[model samples]
Target: MQNNIKIILKIFIYQVIIYLNSILILDTFHEVRGYNITPQGYLSIIFCWISFLPLILLNNQKNPVMVFLWLIYITYIIPVSIIFPLINSASVYSIIFVCTINILFFSSILFFRIIDRITIPKLKIPWDLYKILIIGCGIIVLLFVISNPGLSLIPPNIFKVYSVRQHFKDNTPLLTMYIITNGGYVISPLLLLASLYIRGPIKYLLITISILISYLIYSSSGLKSIAFMNLAVIILYFYIKGTKSISNSVINIILYLFLTAGILYLIFDFYDPLIHWLRRVFFTPTLNTYYFYDYIYNNNSEFTTEAPQIVSQIYYGTSGSANTGFIGDGIARYGTLGLIINFFIFNILIFAMNLSSKKVPFELSTTLYLPFVYTISNSAITALLLTYGLLALSILLFLFPTKTNKIPL
Candidate 1:
């Protein structure tokens, strides 16, 4: 009981620190950028903290999902709230709206936490089936590399040039190639976990093959998110396997910070690559969101179409890929209420799979679910449905098989 009280008190203090840090950072950034922090922005930031409190306080399970979600929130909010104002001063309304949307998103997860306790049954997968799944995924990954040689090993010079251009002339990959490459995203996390568990020459072979396949897929596509997702999986697997404690999770976060800082330093040295990458990762989505606001308020237009369409229509002459993230897309299409409704459904789906992971910790379900959670923050719903969507369905079918399909004892 005393230990429980100490844990609760520690978490409470941590929450306070996070809240204070967010406010101080926002204030400092606004002051430095010659902008005044609005009352609405302050309220929104506080509300954001409140929404996340349930997850922070009530999560006795020490699920890695909380860690990933916290990281995503910090990464997303710090940049948009603090750094983004330097580019352009967003209106108080826009800032508040974004904050509220985040609150809803967090709330959806909390709702799942409650339901997860009651609804999810314990799940188990046979060892033989798990190995077969990993090997089969490995074969498919190799096949992808062999079939799409041109797309698989992109030249560094070409990548550099493409990065500088900030737009690929023929960015639309073949349907077959796209599908095959996505297999890497789906299985890379599984391979990492499998490497940790499986023994002998087979283990080394799986690790080598996974690394090679991941390299080929990321090199061919030049999508930073996929690369980042792969890296996150490897890092997270070690973090989970090594120390399943809150303190260790903090250390893992610090390590991630350093890794991110190192990448940022490299990006600065190679500004052209950074520019192209940021154009897709940060600027385009943000610009689209801003344009979306203008379309509705300034132009007296209703947001009937998707956020990407709005971005494409307003900001022409780029790489025609106008995929704003889930936040932007959700708000643009359905308004705040719509975003809440969609997130509720999304939360349930993700949480169900997450429960399966907890039942049999650090196995196939966990491996499959990690990549999905890592990438879901930044991806559009439609894009995820197309890519990770197929992966999730496969995981459900295999990882959590029906009793009828269960292997005999």
Candidate 2:
């Protein structure tokens, strides 16, 4: 028992550390300063945390999933951190991204339970479904690619380019909030791969073609970064699937990422032959580390400030396009502890929800989807929605389910 307590504490501490690191690591911004504690950002995080108390008390048992997740989080991150031609953007943010996904998983759990009273189980799958899914992806992606303007080749820093929104007037930033350092296009592959478990090849192919076309025409142009990210996604997805143990998965992810990088270099030589050749010859760890470190420490125009208007200006197109959001501000306000606490609280809620036996409510699922994705995407809103949005209300309603008062959980 004593050992278990100690182990739990260790896991808890690890999560806390990771959270804070994520907050501070990525200091990118479109504004001269970071976003301030406006009614929206501040109130949201606070309410989100408070709403999560039930998660702490409810799921309530000592479980290893949290610890394993944290462990896997760190392991998956370290391998391909090298060869980054751009800023690493909060090292801790990656973990935050994963933890935020709890909103989705947790809410789903709640939905299952609530609807369990009247809903039927529906998870049957055909044996040949996965092959069809893959083919479908290829077809869809190819169509999307061919339909839209095809890039002759993927470019460097393709990883960081996000949001296809362009400005019509000079100095006009788009009025959107989701622009962040994304592994954007790379995730497309994982989306393709996910169809593996589902039914249909033509479906996956069609889907891929659609995405490819959308990307070429409507999507952002940068895609080189996605190459590395896509590789990471494949590794991370498998790791998350838990087919391999944490240690084994991490080893394979790193090796495979490097291997993929090599293959990409050789195949992509037709595009930017010079740089590709250069990276092959001299993309050393020392250089990679030095540049990443410089980005985090040396660049700080937007890391320290908390002016809401400034943030709003850029977010609404007054200043400039913010490549990175309030990451620097989050780190400054809470340091690494901030990121960990945020993620831990979110993860704790998700674990609680998933560990539960049935589907959560639909309202909860809807609320959870965007926030869950947002938090994982390194945004502040996900945590808020988890705590105070429709999901929380849905959970409350679920706990006291109706004239019959059935056992939801």
Candidate 3:
């Protein structure tokens, strides 16, 4: 009982430090990016902490999935919620709605303990068939990369990605696109992980081929997240191998990454890539949510399912997608009530993820699932499963061989 109290106290302290770090980042947003962020006095601070209580107080850290989602809330949602009304002429309702949805989101994670207790039956494929499946997937990825028009294997500049992405999308058939993406994103990474148990030149070959294919996929798709996924898998593999604590490692990495981004932005005198990335990742989605509520819903616009697209079209004069959060999409699609709708659908994914994490090594399953989480801030559930390979990845996780069932590679 005493030890439990100490752990809770430590997490609470870390939560306070994270909250302060968010304030510092928001101040940078106001100063560097010219966002008009001002606190609406102590009440806003108090309300923000109130919404944050579920995360700080609840011991949801054992699940890395929950920890990562909370990281998003800390970095993106909390800072924006507090400053929205002050900057964008946002109404009290917007603040209340975002806060309520966030509270529910964080609180729902507490039920993961209950959910994890429900055992998910695993059906393992025969080792021979599994080997064939892995080999077949690798062959398909190679064919796709070789046959694709852009064969440079050199990743496009981040600024030039849209054009490259459009070209790739226009040429690739939808089904083929998904298959190849799953092959690269899911199959190759799994192959890499499985190779760790192998003992021979074949293991090195698998690693080399996997790395090459991942680079080719990123180069072809112009998706930066692909590269990050590879990095995430490697980091998780070694970290879990050493520490065997996925949740704590993930939480610390997220906090440090955010802190480093904020500190770099504060100290740098000139523009740099990290600053651009920091703005894009940390600020854009939250600011876009502000625009969504203030500009779209406030104008009494018709409820449209294409909220992110519409926001992108109107504000940026581009037909591309906006960086709208799930709640923003909810508000723009179905008004305040849509938050509840979005929450249910979003939690279904969370529940599914929690279930999968229970069956496989948390590091393997969670890192493989990271791409889907990366898209949640901007993507609908349909897009996540269909467009982003969540369904395929989930199946792979369920089928993944456990250590006890290991077969020679």
Candidate 4:
């Protein structure tokens, strides 16, 4: 009873922090930073609270993937979908209907257990062969990057990355592009895992090389996510490795980090990084919800089936892509029906991840799973599964040796 109460209190506190953070963004930056807030009446505020109550059900301890998904949804998606829309005076009916779909999609995580009934046939590959294959792929990817658009073309700064990214996409062969992009996802996690379970200077060397390669990839491809991908995986590996409980530990860590950041900001009045983080992590991703909805539903725009970056640029007459969360992307493409389709597709991906989890360590599976979950915040579900190689990642997880021990030299 005491533990349950403590968990409940933590959940409550976490939710309050998120709610307060939304207020902080609104109150602090509404006019000064051009946040686009136009408050509706107090009744809409009540609706946001009611809409967010389903998050408590998200405290399920069974799946770490689900916990990470909920963390992003609660900390970012809910505010954008619910609070931001309300403040913007978007149609209440539209907001409620779309937000309900999001809640249902999140709640369906409970059904992921059904995936356990479908057994995946184990593949028997020698560990030596597997390592060779991963390393060989990594080498090939590096060669591809070096040859196609040599490091001489490295961008000056992250802001310049898009032009270079666009150039790479436009100039590189589609098939080669596919291999190089997907290979990064496949090889980086394996490298991180190898470094973790394997002990010695070799491990240090591997990680150092991985970080450098990530930096080079970012410089060449203009993808900021790729630059820190290995570090994120390493952090997640040790984080879950030390925890006794996965779901609660995840919630507590997120809560404490948020609180710590908030406190530091208050004490020091440090707004630059905090504002940037808020814009990236919260404002831009969520605001895309409003942008897509208004574009499609209110403006009577046709369902978009084109590249999101192209579509967003066309819509806004802007240079940058208004990359949006999956929910927003669905709305942009399919209207009300897009919501259902994206939800179903996302659940399928989760089911695949859940099935693969049986063949790997839970921590390893969840760590590998983070990128896909995180990507859903700013990419389409179709792009995530197909273009982003999440389906391939699931198969990779399923094939990972069930018994991971120290790497023998």
Candidate 5:
């Protein structure tokens, strides 16, 4: 009874804080940073704390690996998303919708798997599945890199789509959001390789060298952020299942947190690879490091009163343009309370994922958690499945059928 009541109270508080955060056009005191943080944001923090009290009461009675698998998947979509409606922009709605859509997507995948069970007239998992999956994963990483290198979380370079500075409706800033939300490409090959190989110090060294080489000239905030994020996800999966070695467990957790601080620093730091590559692709210097801060702080107060614009730039090919603020700016919707809720949600989910992961074997757990590492690299946690290729390869575990051939088992 007490546990249920606490959950009810937390839910009520979460709703109230969410309501306060959505006062974009309604609130009179919104623009003042210090003023809005109280009623709206602070409550989110309070309730966010309240929500975690149930974890202690809950027990993991199911299969550890399976439990982690579910937890990791849920961690990505629920924690922060349950409150996404509180954000002032349509993108927040989009993020929620995306999570819903992803759930459906995975459900469809699950449904397909179930269908396979019933309609198995003649079943043959692909014989060459491992090679195909491995190569496919590498190709995916390459494609993501080639296609979306500029989709950085706080891209120093300002891209003008159709015209300059005025091409977007709501001018929905894509770069920061892209970096902040999506990171499914960077660690794909690394994780895939790790899954396929018997990992040793040498393999890790080589993988680290590859990452360093990739980011040697320009610090790949997106790639590095995403990489570490994948790692965190892996760590969570291991802990949840009780599979991790004690030292490995502590190291992974620390590595995950360290990546967070590093990515935050990168978001503030400047890097110019285009200039280095061509020696003169410089149309302009990078935007001010403090530009996002200025926009949020200066424009947030009621005194400014200007709505977000819908202009476009003629440079790229778009009908919309946007100003970049904090990609994590949605935290401000509920004020300081909401900020706490938002942060607490992330940490709690991470903890949940960690606890659940302990159910899976250490060897199997890395595959599950690899994407969390990449998520940290760029603050992109929009997808729980950070690495697109991991799925393709997981399919190969069936294709190759490593059933009784367990080396470590």
Candidate 6:
């Protein structure tokens, strides 16, 4: 009971820090961009504060799924709430509506008791079949990489050649390659290998090599998020397996935060070439959200063009294009109504995944769920579906379903 109270208190403190961080980021944006916080912006911040209360009050901090959800909230939703309003002068009505949608989306988790009662057939794949599946995926990835020599195997060179947004623009070939190679073949096998790492010394050595190779592939593709996501998965796996303590996890998170801040400071101080690169990756989505509203409200134009096209217009004018974050995409594609619908649907999907994780083996569940958790902030519905679909396929092929008396970490 005392431990639970301590966990709850830690979570409460973390929530406070997240709230303060959101305010700090908003103030920094205002100072840099000279955007005034309107009444709607203030209302949005209020709503954000209110939305977080349910998570805290419900008190499931020790639950891994709940912990992951809270991590997502802190990492993405909090920053997004402030950043979006700072970039776009949304009306109070729209702000309130979006906030209400967010509240409903998160609050739906309280109803997971109903979801937990639904049962599906247990899947069971043999160990031999799992090995075969991993080997097959590795071969496929190798072939794909050989076929596409344009894909760099070095991080710096890849970043030099392609902007983050350019990777997702209307390049069907590159998109197809990503879906086939990275989404389909690479991530699942890497996760499986990572899961096997805790088995023994030889397995640990082999998995380390596999992880290094996977990191190179991901970094070479200029998607730093993939590398970070994999790292998070590995860390969470250790924690789940009881190989790492909560204190260690907290320490690692703090170290990562400090390292990220130090890197950002260096980039700012040195005026490195990467300053513009980082700006384009981080700020373009927020800027585009504002431009999207400008086009719709000020220009009195309908957003008939697809999200990529709209983002392109916002960033590169008439010719170039890029993908925006899920919220921006939702708003652009369907307006406030669309955004509300998307949020609700996304929330339901995540809720189902969370419940399903409890029913499966820890290794399989972690592999299947981590990608979705990491990518939810940045990916559109279509992109998310493709990635999850591929992951589901891998899960079906490699993971044996069993009724485990062991509780989820």
Number of the predicted model whose lDDT against the real structure is largest: 4
Alpha-carbon shift of residue 246 in model 3 (angstroms): 4.2
Q: Give the residue spans of candidate 4 off by over 4 A.
A: 1-8, 27-34, 41-44, 52-62, 88-92, 153-163, 198-212, 306-317, 404-409
- How are the candidates ranked when ordered by TM-score, highest leading? 4, 3, 6, 1, 2, 5
TM-score of each: 0.66, 0.36, 0.82, 0.84, 0.36, 0.68
Query: What value does the lDDT take at residue 324 in candidate 1?
Result: 49
Model 5 stretches with alpha carbons more than 4 Å out? 1-132, 139-222, 227-400, 406-409
Model 6 steric clash pairs: 123-401, 312-321
TM-score of 4: 0.84
Q: Decide which is better by lDDT, 3 or 5.
A: 3
Worst 10 residues of 3 by lDDT: 269-278
What lDDT score goes with residue 147 in model 2?
A: 39
Q: Which ten residues in a row have the lowest lDDT in candidate 4?
A: 32-41
Residue-level lDDT of model 6, residues 346-387, one tens digit each, is 666655565455545554455445555445555576566564
Query: What local lDDT score does residue 230 receive in model 4, on the 0 to 100 scale?
Result: 78
Against the true structure, candidate 2 has what lDDT? Answer: 0.33
lDDT per residue (tens digit) for residues 152-271 in model 1: 465345335455223322543456455544656666655665666557777777777777766665666565545566677766666566765643355345445444544664666543
Predicted candidate 3 versus true structure: per-residue lDDT over 1-409, tens digit per residue: 6645654454444445444544555666555433536644444455555555555544545555665575556555654554454345446676676578667766566555557577767676665566566766777777877787765577989767877777788988877787767766777787788677566776777787788777887788886666666677887667665765445555566556656665675687543433456456555676677777766567888888777777777766677777666777777878777767877877777777766666466666655665555566766656667667777766666666654676674
lDDT of each: 0.52, 0.33, 0.65, 0.66, 0.34, 0.50
| Top TM-score model | 4
| lDDT (C-alpha) at residue 109 in model 3 | 64
For candidate 5, lDDT tens digit of each residue in 197-312? 44445445435433432332122232333344445544554454574333223324433433443354368542232122211111100111012222443356321212122111
What does candidate 2's lDDT look like per residue over 1-409, in tens digits?
5644543444344333323222222221223232111111222222223223223212222222322323223322221122121223334453343233334334433543443355334233332443444344445444434433323333333444543222111222221111111113322443444344345454455346435533442333343333343354445455444442433333344345444554564677432322343232222221222222233344543333332234435334355422221222233335445444544555454444443312432222222222232233232434234322323322332332222222211
Q: Which stretches of candidate 1 lie over 4 Å from their true place?
A: 1-60, 77-99, 119-124, 152-178, 224-232, 246-291, 302-306, 312-323, 362-374, 389-409
The regions of model 3 sitting more than 4 angstroms off are: 1-43, 83-90, 148-160, 244-246, 249-251, 258-275, 316-319
